[model samples]
Target: MPLEFEKPILELEKRIQELKETARTTGVDLEAEIRLLEERLARLKREIYGNLTPWQRVQLARAPGRPTTLDVLEKAFQDFLELHGDRAFADDPAIVGGLAYLEGQKVVVVGHQKGRDTKENLQRNFGMPHPEGYRKAMRLMDLADRFGYPFLSFIDTPGAYPGVSAEERGQAWVIAQSIQRMGRLRVPAVAVILGEGGSGGALAIGVANRVLILENAWYSVISPESCAAILWRDAKEAPKAAEALKLTAQDLLRFKVVDAIIPEPEGGAHKDPERAIQNIKEALLKTLEELKGLSPEALYQDRYRRFRALGVYQD
Candidate 1:
């Protein structure tokens, strides 16, 4: 079911689908009706999506049908060879990465992977990576740097795994190491926030020369629910916390936290994932082109300067 705000759009879409079915079954001329309904659907979608609240946008980012890292790979890349394991502990399914070809250019692709169903989600650890995942990512990133392959990362994790076993495996240390390694990576790297980007888990793979975000994605130091619990003593105040956090793409763009925003389809990315994937492909190509000319030292320096320039304040 669509969210409350999207009911009108979905209703109109349903009507259009019904009209098509009727036309097919009864041989009635419903072209005019279908056309009118589609126009109204388009307008309704634009009006609703364009005016979404931060909390509403957060919901959309977490929508079940939203494209995942594996989906993006299947749609936008070619010859993907998934590399596994950290060569230390076990292979973590929450983080997936390997060599892939993007528009014929060889690149290293890495991202958080959340599953589409309950069983898969459990297998993926709800996309909350453990220490092994971060280490595996760092290993692939180092390989990319060594082989002169552009590194592309898709971030969509709730946070690092907080379970006792993850902590026992030095989760914090591995996350810190990933961040440190990414900061010094000599190759061109780009990261896109496909959905939720929470805390150090997201940042571990997010230190890129270019950071892009989907229109409805949210990136924050903490989840709104968690922040609300900490500040207001109740998780029910999450909507208010979301408003105050400025985690939306537009807000982050204005604050210079993101490099670009790739606009989603009318309702959201989940509603039209193929279009969203196409938009992302275009953005990646353009960004890669822009970064192709820089020397390794220049790439490192530019990435450093980009992060350094964030959080300017006037008091």
Candidate 2:
């Protein structure tokens, strides 16, 4: 199903299809009319997607069929040897990590993995990691540091699991540990916000030398719906809260929260997954190339300075 804001675009597309079918079946020459509608469609896409509000971008980030971490691993990298288990407890499916080759350069990749449907969502816990998940991520970071491989992380979770079981197992502590681990890694690290990037779940693996986000992705401490519920006592006020939170990619880029924005295909990533993943591949390779010359100590200092400079205020 198309999102509410996308209905107009889809309706126009449907009309164009109908006209094409009519012309084909009735042997009518509608080439001129079809060409006009095609031109209008291109302009409509730019007008709508190019001017998306923060809330609309959020909707796009959460849209169904948006490419998942596994999808990127498959399409953007090669020879992904998935590693499981945190070595302390059972492995958490919400977080996935492995060794992969990016344009023939070995790297360690870790990310939150959401599912495609309700049954799989339940199994993946809606991409909300538990303590073990963060631990697993830390394990991968350690591997990267040990082998001098660059680290790549994908951020795409609503938040860490908040249930009593997760808490009992030390969710917050593990998250903090993961953030500290990523910060201290000697290898170059880069993180991309593929989707939601909500709260500690995203940040646990997100501390890196360069943080990038997709054009339609968002990164925030809390989701707009949750913020609206808390601030306005109504979830329906999420659009207003979204504007106030400044979580969109453009907003984050303005604030220097993200280093760069990878442009998505028209409509959204789900509309053209291959193009979106290819964009990510190019960005990652370019960023890694930029970081290639820095020594390990230089990389550490670079990351330290980058983060220490965040949120600086002027009187």
Whose TM-score is greatest here? 2
Supply candidate 2's per-residue lDDT for 245.
97
TM-score of each: 0.93, 0.98
Clashes of 1: 0
Q: What TM-score does structure 1 among the candidates reach?
A: 0.93
- The all-Cα superposition gives candidate 2 an RMSD in Å to the true structure of 1.0
Model 2, span 1-315: residue lDDT tens? 789998888988999999999999999999999999999999998999889999999999999889999999999999999999999989999999999999899999999999989899999999999999999999999999999999999999999988999999998899899999999999999999999999988999999999999999999999999999999999999999999999999889998899999999988999999999999999999999999999999999999998898895787
As a TM-score, model 2 comes out at 0.98
Error of 2 at 296 (Å): 1.1
lDDT of 2 at 156: 97
